[model samples]
Target: MTTAPVQKSSYDRYPTVPLPAGESVITGAAAWHRVRDLAYERAEDRPPLIVVDTYPGVDLPELTRQLAEAWPTAVIIDVEQEAAKPIEEIDARIADNLTDDRVFGVMSHLRLNAFYDQERLAALAERLADRTAATVLIGWGAALTATRPDALVLVDLARWEIQQRQRAGAPNWRSANGAEDNLRKYKRGFFVEWRVADRHKRDLFAKIDFLLDGNAIGHSSGVVRGPGMITGDAFRGALAAAVNAPLRVVPFFDPGVWGGHWMQDKLGLDTETPNYAWCFDCVPEENSLLLSDGDHAVEIPALDLVLTQPRGLLGAKTYARFGAEFPIRFDFLDTVGGGNLSLQVHPLTDYITDTFGMHYTQDESYYLLDADEDAVVYLGLKSGIDPDAMIADLRAAQQADHPFDTEKYVNAFPARKHDHFSIPAGTVHCSGANSMVLEISATPFIFTFKLWDWGRVGLDGVPRPVHVDHGAANIQWDRDTEWVTEHLLQGPEELSRDGDVIEERTGLHELEFIEVRRHWFENHADHDTDGTVNVLNLVEGDEVEVISPTGAFAPLRIHYAETFIIPAAVGPYRIRRTENSQSTRFATVKAYVRGTTRTDQEGPALAAGNKGVRS
Candidate 1:
């Protein structure tokens, strides 16, 4: 319950893109002045109409109070109170998606417009038809109240910040559940609120006159403060620059029941917290991006880049396959000097699609960054295990006096530094204590069905959710010790070598869509995105520089344990050791979507197998 103490760290947690020399962000009172000036410029004969559309979790009362102070004479309408449906009605509509389960829910297909009453919307529009004085409309769906506003301002918030607010007792949009559990709150946001808001947000990116940083407010002791505003041109330019070069999202660390001290020591995180369990470095859905002009920066959701530049950031092949979604995810899991992770299995593809509305399932791999001598990874199942008996034992473990004998049913493999273990869907797996892992996998990350938690509770003093019935239906009984040893225990195979640079193919299992490659170099290494986005991490060195061959982008310096992205449009680039790096040899692990076919010059096929469906 204590706040995490701030500490100086070498990790570049707040990565930013410098704006052009002549352009700078406007903040505080100046931001409101600029908005007023833009509104006057957009005015024709009558007074202008300004619409401030907001994402959920924005400080509406504070923003409105400020707007009232700035424009005392303007008529301000609260869009939700005027046009949105009642809280009870809205809850009923989304009840199916926001299921009773605390941690899981079906993905919603509803749009923002569905939350509003059409008759009320018409009435609100009628009132603003002949306004003499300036008028202002604001709320989550404010833009829906007017057809063509003279001035449109978008207020955006990152999902991670939203989670922080929820944990601090903020309710979901238009709901009165501030006292609810954090898991249920997160489930509602993940399944229903965020989906509808994103659908509405994507349609406004092309037309907004200005973008406001909702995350910048109320930062009493941070490097940046709120009310930051940027011209639409600057906003679009920043996103364009990110797609053409290497970039990183702001990383966030959280404490867990099985958390460890590795991140605290390595990443320079807060030592006051009990432990750091996870670091979300590349999950765009819950990360923020900073756009700066050297002197000042504005923080916005990283999802904005994906929504605005889907084709450029994700590449044509990836965008077409996933439809504006970033399919790959990279995160850190620390269990060193702590407890083991929960025994879990991901639902098969067919099961996920049928039950959760997800097109793809989570197929993941753990790349050990560092490990203690006693580190181990539980994978697959012990050979010749009885399926029915295993399920019964797992069910019985839920009782107060029983503990599931994990070693009796699962195969434990020795874990070491740089070891890669492939985990296809339906395979049971968990990392044991004393291991620092860099997990790379598909982005459907919340689908894990925990079968056991080593008889432990969460940091909140609550028992974690267990999905034994779900796991029972999806476990691949055939994936026993022998099958796992043959297919899942991956050893690096040398793919090519040139002088000091060596490339090796690491396994993610042929059944999985992601392809991983490790590169080691003393001088420099060449890489091509090959029409797909590449996510890489400096797994072995202190620092390295990423540069484009054609001078397409400015050089980007990456530090140890940092994850950076190279968009597909980058074409050809090179990574070389920085002058400050102490290590003679450097290493990086890169991941991308696997192509359906291979060329003769690319080498023998490393991944070739059909993903099976659940029976």
Candidate 2:
């Protein structure tokens, strides 16, 4: 069968939700001028105090300079310099969480106030209270300096942007370790800085006077880089709109040792990069959300939507279970024209909880998007393989100059387009070369325990860290060839079919909390969120349209390989072929929390049975 050539540049790198009408976003000089006006307008009685609380990784010096330039006579206080604990002291306090391990760390419970000197904070607050001049306080913990401010502006940066800045040699907040390894910097941000900042920022969301887009800063001329500012009410409205409709997080691509040419060619990414290995398409913790007001869009951490509207976005049960976390993650693992992924295993739930203080583990699956004739997937282990022998070889491979004998122990299954491999936690697995993979998994994304890396160094020329001991402990020895074929290798088990739509249950393994479904439709497919969020990617065909049956949301067009999310509140929706699509049929693989129930009210014929359609 011949298929039309996939559209070039069909993948949307920047997906945004439209803000309500009349919601304006100001940027650059206008944004600065508006801050100046707000500072003056609220200073009728006391010294005007404008607290520009920032997420870590923002350019603080530049922000302070911009504020000074805007209000020449105002007193600008660098709150971190005045009130933050010394870098050495802060390091000592978070050392337990920031273990020497290169990749793993304990999630921190520390709040933003914990990183500041209480006495110094009091002194700064007192000093600001007595000052008669208009003062601007700016830093990560700027809001903590005042009980109430005349104008509270938050300069927010997305985690993905923060990572880019880290890659470009920016240090963690208040740390002078610009030369540190990017992984260690990321660990600090993930376990300590980001947690503390988000906790502090969440409380201020409703109280914020203005929201500034810090992700756009620090670009050279002709890059269209400038801070965008929106009113607090408008920002809240955008967040509400996002949770009530289908939306997408801004996707980001990165290169790796096992990178491929597919994304660079198909996704129209920068061709200059050696290869693009990973596309973090729906990892909300690290991705961003762009809120556009027709003309300008402000980028903020997508986690903000989860943090602020957990109920509306995640639904009541999921929010209650995960506690404001977007537990499901969907990303792309590209190995086409590249090397195999490192042999790895995720920790079991009990092990992860005991070791890292995380409540859940990375239960994941790999859905093949495209594969070459020779593509393969390393999954489970050869039947009756000695666990001790495998562990010893893995350990020796990590220390010595030899590559681990992969096929000797692990089962290598031939991978084909549309094949789904279920990889529950503790299942040893990796996507082999010449395959495009859509990884649907739980969101504890960084806890991968690599057993073997095929003896390759990273792009930085440093040997990638292999956790043989951790992998040995976590590997489920029982998941052998026979067990894997019967369990891990799953199906497109047809659940139901209407006139032109067929829905099938795809395996995420019964051990996992996530459920997957594949829908093949020539005309239209009916779907309901069933009181839980649904994430899907158009795995087949050029383009499709996601529409609300009741006009609950604007129709969203999804191209092949583009991932989008339907919030639990976006009850009933339909996916149909777009007028521009040339394909005879289309397929979408969707995922949602297992056991979520459908509402009493259904949409159409195919949506009648609760179990007939999943995700």
Candidate 3:
């Protein structure tokens, strides 16, 4: 099939979401009155519940007082005060309650979900109802047992904002040692604890009446209608409008031992932290969507969109393949000016499910973005390398506290910008220093088994733990240097050329559920999701605009290194090139689920060239 030219229509302009500044929406005492007015039309029998759920250490006493003044007959009830046990007692209980080997990540302190007793809160809500006056329950999980509040306001702070607040030495209920322990656990892995805590809060989305922007809390804040208050019919209509429009998720960053300055310096991220290691560009599990209604912005977990509109976001085929789960994930791994990452491998599909209570495995690939002239990526094993010998060496190094020559066993390939390396489950891989890699993979993250860490200690001055036995069991012994070069080591191949645009395909291994392609164009390119969700990354060029064919969406402008997703509901959409002084040719990486039927676009699909599976 030949390519077509870019179509011009009335909606051929850049898409913009008008989000008013936080100060304009909510600032001081005047702003408090405006926030109180959100529940003005409601009856007195069911009082407005403005649950100011702030991050730890963020005291909302002043806001609470203002809320009381706005409703003279309303009584403020702090959930923290209603706790059945003291903070110290809860801490001890949590320490003694551990019986499993579950991991802890960023939300470490909440692993036990030990803050308050749910039964107590439910009973408290009942007793408070006996009073003749209106009741305003304010605190985290306050609305969990609330009796149909007129309003439920959620004050959420970004991850970075929480980090900054903690670094500023704000007073938290936890002790200094407890805080330090949580931080250490976060660096180890944030998914285990975070997911558990978040699963309970999923229903909170349906309960939220208003969302308060806490990005600049104490200075400025913004409040908008929440997704929970919208009816199903209304949400469906809004979802349709959003699908045709370009959507961007609120990306989050975390630091690691092998973090680099590439994202910190190039992306102009927060340098106050150690360094930027991983950027969750489009991972719905940990990312949130910033939706604006022309006046205010509300933040909702990206999973909410997937859960509510799976077919609309993920195409029918993709939704069937992975129901209510965003299968693809785009993230950045920056090791520039830092040390090499740990030599690791993920478990196979069946292994992961049997071991960890997860249904899917984390099959991933590395797309080199920025690299030093001599940068190398360690992958697979050297020819004639013995698996038993390597396992013994790893164990010996761990016991002796000594570093071994890892280069002697593993093969290293020259890493250049735009190089694609397929790393299916059981393949040993690690991005070396001085390279920034974009990791496109399955959404089941945080299951890496680190075999070696170069004998280095973590930022906490303690040696990071390694799982040599786990890695040894999962490593594919047959994947040697020759296998790596013949299968994983390859570049994007030109598939079809049409005018100034050319479609180049890469990472087409059978082991991977998703396929990647790069579109090189000077002006614009046409693409169809084809019953699947398409994730786009502007790897090259300054900025580009994504426009819908039927003028259903507002034109969205995406800059270099930024990632965005086009829902399957969009169907056929055009990616129009925008003017940029930096470069002329715009190169974007498009990823989507591999169709059941395959065909030759311009040539044959690039094959992994591997024969054995689970051998």
Q: Which regions of candidate 2 deviate over 4 angstroms?
A: 1-7, 219-223, 599-615
* Winner by lDDT: 1
TM-scores, one per candidate: 0.96, 0.95, 0.80
Residue-by-residue lDDT tens digits, candidate 3, 1-615: 333332332211112233332312333444445445665557444545545443343345644665666566667788767843565775565552232333322223343245667778767877766645556777655655564666666655444444445545433433343345444434322433234334544455565555554444443222323211222233334445565556877777778898998887777665666777888888876676555545544454566577667888887777888777899999999999988999988888877776654678888888888899878888899999878888888888886556767898999888888777778899988999999999888887777888998877777577777888778889998989898777776545667899999987776466777788888888899988776789988888877888888887778878778888988878778987765435788888888887622332336643532211110
- For model 1, residues 175-229, the per-residue Cα lDDT tens digits are 8899898899999999999999999988898888888888865421134555688
Candidate 2 residues 455-571, lDDT tens each? 999998888988988898889999899888777664456767888898777766667888778899998899989899999999989999999998978999998899999999999
Model 3 local distance difference test score: 0.66
Question: What's model 3's lDDT at 176?
Answer: 44
Go through the candidates in order and give the C-alpha RMSD of each one to the true structure. 3.0, 4.4, 7.6
Error of 3 at 532 (Å): 1.7
List lDDT for all candidates, in order. 0.87, 0.86, 0.66
